[model samples]
Target: MAVLTTTVLRLEKSRRTTKKLKDNVVAYGFLAGGLICFGLFSWYPAFRALVLAFQQTNSVDEPTWVGLENFRLLFGDPEFVAAWRNTFYFTGLALVIGFLVPFALAVLLNELRHAKAFFRLAVYLPVMIPPVVTALLWKWFYDPGPGLFNEVLRFLHLPTSDWTNSTNTALISLVLVATWANLGGTVLIYLAALQGIPGELYEAAELDGASVWQRIRHVTIPQTRFVMLMLLLLQIVATMQVFTEPYIMTGGGPEDATITVLYLIYKYAFVYLDYGSACALSAMLLAFLGVFSALYLRLTREAT
Candidate 1:
């Protein structure tokens, strides 16, 4: 009788183990296609880019290992310095204008008790348009003669200025176009974050005689600090890689005033046929962004 009981228990355990193994096999089968695609498209390309950074290749001949020659050439170029400076300036200007406007708009939209849907739609409408379309639309608006902006200025009897045509204002013009096109997404994100804030906090602040600004400073900002930090980092990363606005609108013209690092990389690879230097520059940008992302993650984690 004891032997029979032991045999039955062993059979049940064996059945459970087999079932578990079969389930795992099914799960792995489902994941296999996605894993293969990721390896082929993402991982392999990334590894190749890294390898290309170290070798000089024109795609027609035997590749030569150039070591640090590409980096040396990139750093010594005057346009490289100018490109970094311009990129930084664009990023800074973008942060000053683009970053705060969306948050402010979100806060204002949050306070509205009527026409909320309409307002939200208005804010997010620009994001629905294709980036190329937005760039072309703004390019027309920036035209000195029949441009909408200059026409408005002319009607108001104000001096109409050369926008993207001049080196003085080309970068700023691009920044404005970029800010207008991109802020819709940020506004929506901020609005979502604002909505997630508990109403009780505002009530408590009001009970303590906090003014509107005081409530926002003490309660609203503190509650949404995490979202703000994350968005700020994202904005930095996005602005650093800015290419489309300058590429489509300015063409990095007006004495290279609007040139960015990414634009420079594109020129190096395609225009100059120097893939090695382009790859090296890309590697550097990737490394910098990776470090920035790591620090951002660590800081956010600690703050949380």
Candidate 2:
């Protein structure tokens, strides 16, 4: 009787072990599918691009290893330097305008007592619109003749100015469009961060006779610093890759004033059929962004 009982317990244990192993295999099988997809679509492309950066290739002929020749040609090009400068300038402008507007809008929205949902929806509506559509809409808005913006100015008896037509205004006009279109999502994120802040902190600030701006400076900013920093990094990285706006709006026009690194990359790859140069430029951008992110995160982590 004892031997039979022990044998029954052993069989049950064996069955449980087999079930656990089967479950793990099933989970790993699903995970493997996702890994395979990423390997094919993401990792492989990145690796291929990196390899092509060092090799002369048109995707037809056998690629010849050129080793830094593409990069040398890239650096020698005046437009390459101009693209970097323009990208940095755009990033700075975006940080100044795009970075602040969303936070301010979020704060205003958070303070409103009624119709909060309506305001939030209004703020986020632009985000739902396709980026290409947004760019097209802004292109019309920036048109000098019979454009909505110029019309508004004329209606107010103000002088109509060149928007995307002149080099002076072209880059900044695109910046404005980008800020308006992208600010919606940033505002919503700030709003979420604001909501997560403990209400009691605001109450304490009020009790201490802190004014609105003071409360925001002393309490709100500190609480949301992490979110702000993260968004700052993301914004810089994103603005550095400003392609769509230039592509759709300015086409890197007005003497290449609005040309950015990514747009230049596009020109290299598609227009000039210089895939090697394009890949080299992409590698440079990737390296810069990777280093910047790492350093920024380390500094921010230490500060916090």
Candidate 3:
């Protein structure tokens, strides 16, 4: 019987090999097309960016290779350093405040006994607003003199605060706007993950007399760990690359307090006409995110 099974397996393998060889032309044709497109857009551009990072361009004419001058200047540049600091600070703040809120909100939304669609829509409505419009609206809200924030403070006799203008609060203010803008998407993601969890797990936990918190701590969290990691990594990348809010609202101003990584890159490329330095900065950002993504992938693979 064992010899017969081995013979059958060999026969199947031979048949499969023959079929694949017969279709080799079509397979190789598709592979060639894929490689061409990938090279044209992804691979070639990536290599070109690295090349340009080592070269100088005045935004016209041929680029001149300048070796490591761009990287050296980038490291020594004061504005670049400040932008780096602010960008990391924003990412840290958002990771803490932005990461947990949406998950909690999603869990709450999932538990809704009535008006579920209304609650979902209400939470997601702000995300539908154009980013520029959202930035402008927040600018109005955070306005020191006549803004709603200060007005509310005065009504409640709380101390009035300079939100966007004050260096101490500008980054936090931007984080608030980011959290508000992104909460809906995060909530939706968590909702889907939460719903994907099998009902039988909860039933078994309940039968074991597990309290609600106990069940959530053990079952809910473990089941959704993959989704949590995905969202966390995505937030890290997105928050690290933040530019639009500061660009539109502060102009990297209030004493350059709100300038972020991509903001610095923008200044290098467009404002300062140093495309080389900009590419170098971009490469650094890519390196940072690559490390994060690699770690996540390793952890995920090990778990599975």
Q: What TM-score against the true fold does each predicted structure earn?
A: 0.95, 0.96, 0.85
Under the 3 Å rule for N, CA and C atoms, how many clashes does model 1 have? 0
Evaluated at residue 79, the lDDT of candidate 3 is 87
Q: Kindly give the number of clashing pairs for every candidate.
A: 0, 0, 0
lDDT of 3 at 278: 91
- Clash pairs detected, candidate 2: none
Q: What's the alpha carbon RMSD for model 2? A: 1.5
Which whole-number lDDT from 0 to 100 does residue 85 have in model 1?
94
Q: Model 3 off-target regions past 4 Å?
A: 1-43
Which stretch of 10 consecutive residues in model 2 shows the poorest summed lDDT?
Answer: 295-304
Model 3 scores a C-alpha lDDT of 0.91
User: How many clashes does the backbone of model 3 have?
Assistant: 0
lDDT of 2 by residue, 167-264 (tens): 89999999999999998999999999999999999999999999999999999999999999999999999999999999999899889999999999
Ranking by TM-score: 2, 1, 3
Quote model 2's TM-score. 0.96
lDDT value, residue 87 of candidate 2: 96
lDDT of 1 by residue, 9-77 (tens): 999999999999999999999999999999999999888888889889875776799999999999999
| Alpha-carbon runs more than 4 Å astray in model 1 | none
